[model samples]
Target: MATPATTAATSAVSVRLDALIAQRLAARALVLAASRKVAADSSGIKTSRFRGRGVDYVESRAYQPGDDIRSMDWRVTARTGRPHTKVFQEERERSVLFVLDHNPSMQFGTRVRFKSVQAARAAALIAWSAVRGGDRVGAVGFGGGVTGEVRPAGGPRGALRCLRSFVEWDALARATQTASPLSEALERTRRLARPGSLVIVATDGFCADAAAQAPLTRLATHCDIKVLMLTDALELAAPPRGRYTFAIGGERRRFEFGDGAHDGAWVEAFRRRRATFVDAARKLGIAVLPVDTRDELARSLALLGLALAARRGAA
Candidate 1:
């Protein structure tokens, strides 16, 4: 018989498409407003800093000194018998790309959900938020020898598409051994992301080694990048003093857990893995947010500041 904790853990090992889709409602709380640095063009809801010579005409105003002569509204000027210039807003739909990692390392969690599930939830919420903000949603998934890509697209269609892809990719993760490296995924993302796009990477940082640095640096130059560092309570702190048993490759092993030299080393290993990833991201001007498996989805989103305070460099 399975204990309640064991049952809960089993239930959360993977995510369902409906659960991801349901996040649309919760995503409304997310604030993805545009900042001055973000670009905009045609077919976008977020107002762009640029005005003249773009799609979505705002209105015609009386001609002013130094106004672009090319923007003169001949029809309005002819009707009003006064020189007028057409005002337009560049409404380019910004792209938000999610790079999700589902390596075997993320498959373990001692809390409400696996690290992989938490990552999926975070990505889903962000994707829906992006769509609500009138931005395009795209994704790249790597791990378990499976690679999935969804092209950038806008509105519910795009959000739903990405959600479906998440489910498919996650299923693959649960069934296969992880083979793709995080560096490879980042390189692929570098190619997919356009200038002025925002890329959100969801991973446990297990495979984010030195090899991934170059790709992240290049991507940071043109794209705004955010890292969701998926973590669990077990990984963040030392376990309670006790004897822990583990089964590896069909063999059983036991180890003593306590505030000993080895215990400190174990904790430090997890810290180093997290610090290395976070430090590199910060150095490149990328924002890093830690998401825990034990957190509720809404609370997690808030903590991540999916409100994106980082847009103003406040994070």
Candidate 2:
């Protein structure tokens, strides 16, 4: 038998809570712009004729063996009697790749909505913002069998599709069957993107594989990887001593949740699976974004932006 209070709490935290989060996202604060245009620059500075990047003409040194022929300063080569290449730096187009985890466990969240819902929203915001910033935005959504696959679409329509695909994705998650491994999917993502591309990975960071560290390291080596490590606040926290038993549609189960701080022999055990996920993030140099559905999106976005900027500086 279960106490009325426990049952009430469980009932409140059921799947229906997701509806509330969706509603919050729908009722965005204000002035939500889905499109953006690049502004003309007139600082007496022009795109490099050779590189098309914002590279000022620095003095050219003798061309090294690996120097690109395309960058060869023909005039300098003729006068200096030695091959020399112009150097240019990129001041433009930021390509961003967003990876989403549509895993079964993500389908569950104890608070407002599922972590999947939050993950989708975060991905959508980043995708839209990237496109808005004149950066190409692409997404690879998987979990219930690779729901949406769009590769760095450019323009307002592309951003809209990113949002729409997220909203339209089937809510069902497949916990069964031979699902794709994160490693293979990561490899595929690497193939689609080039170095210096921003890769945002959204996942609970849990896989059945015994060795999760290796693949993540490999992923980091190829791209500027940022991890949106998703988890519920409560799940990450060790709850007060308690127990739960429940029945749903017929099947019944029980769980013990607590921190054994109540007595010397009692052991406090919150899943703490998120700790392992965080470890993987640190090991792989991933930028972790802890998402709470109850938190405001604007605030979260600001936090993410600052975090990203710092990460970029460090990188």
Candidate 3:
């Protein structure tokens, strides 16, 4: 049984909209590297153009030996009776929209903070990064049969408005009993996100069925999609065999785990569900980042930033 002080502490760290908002400055610093590529691209372009990398058309020129034959300018080549290739420039100012899930499943966490809080922190970091990078920032926060959307806009004002929505929607998530399908929220996002935008989804992988995946696939057709799966250690593996009591909705519930078989099954189920969602997302050409609740949100997001930078470098 947990002592009163321990219970109070747990409750305190559950989810606080104000606390999340207060950490914005620290979060901004942590994700600085993640958006550096976007900032660089927005400022200027490199002399070398990479073909088949979703760049904007620049001009047509005589084909070079090393140029991709597939990019040959058919009309230009026909008119000049010589091979020509298309040149493209990297785009400036990509839009970044966050799709945050604040459902009941994300409201539970046994460690430092609830998954919902971590998701909000991650969203804030990304929002600030987009602002610094000169990309438009926006978000759709959904759960408990409600959805809050912030239109994409540039600079700090846009970032702050998105952060405010995160806080409000997270609070509503805790109080409502109705479940919001992840697919519906994703469809809404797909409708709002423009082509060439980057969509980041922060969720607990709940309700990730074919319906949910369909919208993401549609969104990916014209936008860069990334999924941040938030999870806790307990979800990955069960605790040691023992009887434990948990406080749920102000009521104490006792659960006994004397045998490891049941616990193993539970862990396996979780693993399978996560694997399914990850595999599906990858198939759709979406990047997946798993954020554990035990890890500090700042460090995890920084690492994610580094990964994004590497991906851009490769591109």
Candidate 4:
């Protein structure tokens, strides 16, 4: 039988509006980069080596083999008697989209908080950070047979709007009894997000299986992608050597862990799922952070900041 103390602790950590709102304080200290916009012809930020026509001329560079003929710096080429190409910088306006998964599976957690709640917390921090970084923030919250979207807008107002949507959509997920696949949300994201935007996905790996890969890959081709894979310790490994029992739907069920009979398969299933997600992310040059439910909010944010920093360095 579960103790009242344990139940109370879980209740306290359930998805709450106040808890997410408080993340505003941590947002100021986030180390995420100030995003750079990309024009229609470009596939990434202006900082990338991508060439395109833009509103402002940055410089003229020696013409490379693959340099676009349309960008030839005729004046520079004539003055220096050498082939040159114009490098133009795009105007600054960035969009950061958060794809939050609140499926029924995410509502389960044996730790301090549900995976859904943890996802909400992480999304809140990132959205707030995006606003602080002067990027327009938006979100697509899907689950519970409901899909909600808030378009990208700059400043605190946009972040606040996303927070409200998070709370409302999460409530719907908790109230409903259906599960929505991660692919559905990603498909919606594809339609909603523009090229060169940054897309952050927060979810438990339950619904992130093979079916979700196509849209993910397509989305990554055009935008910067970051993933927050929320997990519980129980999902990573079998419990200590013992027999644990629980009640489900008025029936008590027993589960044995640490026994060699099934522990390997149990652990391997999770490992395989995680590997698939990692493999896909890596193939698309995306950054991924596996966040444990046991981790503090600050730790998760710090890890995310570090991941983004490393990605920026690589770029």
Best by TM-score: 1
Per-residue lDDT of 1-315 in model 2, one digit per residue for the tens? Answer: 879876555433332233323433432331132111111122343433233223345567788897767678999999988888887654355567887776666666767666777777667666655654566777776666665677777766666666655554434443332244566557567667755578888887664243555766766764677777776765655445677775644689865756454332222233344556577678666778766755555566665554343322322
In TM-score terms, candidate 3 sits at 0.75
- lDDT, candidate 2, residue 241? 62
Top-down TM-score ranking? 1, 4, 3, 2
The candidate scoring highest on lDDT is 1
Candidate 1 residue-wise lDDT, 1-315, digit = tens: 989876555558887776788787778755533322232322344432666444478999999999988789999999999999989764467788999997888888888888888898889888887777678899999988668899999999999899888888888888996656778999999888876678999998887777888998988876878888899998877789999898876799997888688688878999887777788899987878788998776666674443443332321
* Per-model TM against the reference: 0.76, 0.64, 0.75, 0.76
What root-mean-square deviation over C-alphas does model 4 reach? 7.9
lDDT tens per residue, model 4, 1-315: 769886557544466677788888877666532222112223453544333554468899999998889789999999999999998765355688999888777877777778888888888888777677567889998777668899999998998898888888877888884777878888999998887678999877666667778999888876878888888888887888888897766699997887786888878887776687778788888878888777776666675655444334334
Across 197-278, the per-residue lDDT of candidate 3 in tens digits comes to 7889998887576687788778887788888899988898787788888887779998777577888886888888677678
Candidate-wise lDDT, in order: 0.79, 0.59, 0.76, 0.76
TM-score of 4: 0.76
Global local distance difference test of model 1:
0.79
Shift of residue 139 alpha carbon in model 2, Å:
0.7
